[model samples]
Target: MGPVANVHADTLLIVGDSLSAAHGIEREAGWVALLRERVGDAHEVVNASISGDTTSGGAARLPDLLERHSPDIVLLELGGNDGLRGLSPQQMKLNLRTMIEKSQAADARVLLLGIEIPPNYGAAYTDAFRGVFRQLSEEYAVPLVPFILDGVALQDDMMQEDGIHPNAAAQPTILDNVWEKLGPMLSRDTDRNE
Candidate 1:
């Protein structure tokens, strides 16, 4: 074997929940993994996603990771667990806001990944939860993807048995959705020192 490749020599930290954690799928098949594959030699992806984690959980963990990795960019994908647990949308928003602000303070560019709840949750709550991301993105002036799941969420075959997480087959589509917005950010090599 030749020398092991250091894919993430320049890291991009991913802070999120089970959906970002890849849940039932192997780590390599998750969207983050797909991103690593797509980004190739240009960047390294440091996934800090934890299964069952909420926005608050991610907020709490952000400081240490930020200090450690000092990533060039952050893929912030939280709030889904907060929605699933029926937490107040305001609290979720606050948690996400805190995370986004912290990343900015650390001089890391952020890409906020929005999430949606099932229709059964009632339109009002669903709308409020979905709206949090848009509000935060506008407030922080950060780029946002309207929905992380995109093409995978409603498709039975694209999801696992849980119907919440996407299957490996669906990762490429997810990557495409994320890349649509994130690609531009990566293309511009913003000097971290500036």
Candidate 2:
């Protein structure tokens, strides 16, 4: 008998804030763009990021995006705008959890991208905000990248004039950070189970 072959193109949906929205950067130069290069033709990436989007906003819009894209994987990169706006961490957690549940219900594998608050924000609130991602990752048992900006967030030269958002030059590093955890998930046979 001939060997059974398993080959199916996957789709990735990225939902996040300005970071993923390619704010002040060319769409082709953002990390998501770089990610496309890394994944190649094995997957189609649909970026649903919106500038200034919060977890609440992402939660609200997620269903529509999921319906439209019907992606195999969903990269959830929200909460940065919520932290910047000083919104309640609990509310951010709620919003993110709801979005994750909705994506899972639709049979999409999820990669939660965590973000850190600028040190200027009060330590307590920032810690709580950061903790939310960890808690949800544990709760949902999904893979998570500890910090999406890792190498770029602290580098002055890598940031934009506004002191937020990575410059085009730093996008490769961001893509690397995300791909470190996300790549294996995408390449694994289990991803096909979705």
Candidate 3:
């Protein structure tokens, strides 16, 4: 854990909702914390996730976060609340775009962590909801983790009683999912910083 020569190029900021917030688990046991441990002081990880936060909230709060942290990478794990609440996917997309643009303008690399709503929401609506992340990734040229909870969400043993959030045991898997995209980003950022 050496001192970072440039904080802005070594800090990793995560703006997300309950999933990233570690809603029903210990803070240190959450996937974000696991990510912190995995990085092992290579970069500072700041978790600014708020439970029940929507994309609109993240968009509204991003400028302050960017200005404060000057992160090299920004992970967005929002929109689950919006989908759960049946918010318009167009609005969600716009909000996400705003956040992405802001992060890019701030010179930070962006990673989109896509999430899916339950199948009960009807295929058309669910598809649109999921498509927002893909479209944004394409339009903005940012990396996307197609489904952050891909394996954990469906497994009963991995999920919490509410069935929405993953349990403590699932943290490692979540970190692995995020690391798939995030690892490369961190390497690139490190190379650039050096």
Candidate 4:
């Protein structure tokens, strides 16, 4: 969709890991790029994702990103790498909560992009990691895209050879998942501005 007629665009800053960094693929083929196309002139999408970044890294870098972009929306997509590394879920939650609190303090609406690690991580750990996003979203009153790679991850063709990152073909599907929650936020933001 194109920009809303005569509506001012909002800046959307994405702070994520390899999933949003378009690892092992063309940068333009990443889901964040697809999101730029989807929102058109309605919003400015800033991709600040780093390959192999964890929640702790995101927490440390967020203040800089927030100051640099002053985004109307901040998308949090960290924690996957933390889970893959077997980091403590409690620490991950603390890092995420720190990011969320910082973003809200800066007056940027936050959107948590939930992530689910492979079951190999064990039910106890994986469940806790997955629940962090939900807990934070509910606690902070922010919107969440439950499992950003929802329709894409399970499909072999949609993923890259490593099976960790989604391929170009899966970008649109990932964007659709984010759009489900993001669209409403955009609408509400636009309405409020008017």
Q: Pick the candidate with the highest lDDT.
A: 3
How would you encode candidate 4's per-residue C-alpha lDDT over 124-169 as one tens digit per residue? Answer: 9988988998999999999999799999887999998898989889
TM-score of each: 0.92, 0.93, 0.95, 0.94
Write out the backbone clash pairs for model 3.
none
Tens-digit lDDT track of model 1 for 1-194:
89987543557899988887889999998888888888877787899999999998999999999999999889999988899999999999999989988999999989999999999999999999999999999998999999989888989999998888899999888889889988888766634323
- Candidate 3 accuracy as lDDT: 0.94
How many clashes would you count in candidate 4?
Answer: 0
Total clashing residue pairs per candidate?
A: 1, 0, 0, 0
Model 4 ranges off by over 4 Å: 1-7
For 1-194, candidate 2 gives per-residue lDDT tens digits of 99664477788999988999889999999999988988787788899999999999999999999999998899999999998889999999999999999999999989999999997898899899989999999999999998999989879999999988899998999899998888898768445565
List the global CA lDDT of all models.
Answer: 0.89, 0.91, 0.94, 0.92
Worst 10 residues of 4 by lDDT: 2-11
| Model 4 CA lDDT for position 51 | 96
lDDT of 1 at 141: 90
**Candidate 1: which stretches are off by over 4 Å?**
1-10, 190-194
lDDT (Cα) of model 4: 0.92
Q: What TM-score does candidate 2 reach?
A: 0.93
Q: Candidates 3 and 4: which is better by TM-score?
A: 3
Please report how far candidate 4 places residue 66 from its true position, in Å.
0.9
Cα lDDT of candidate 1 equals 0.89
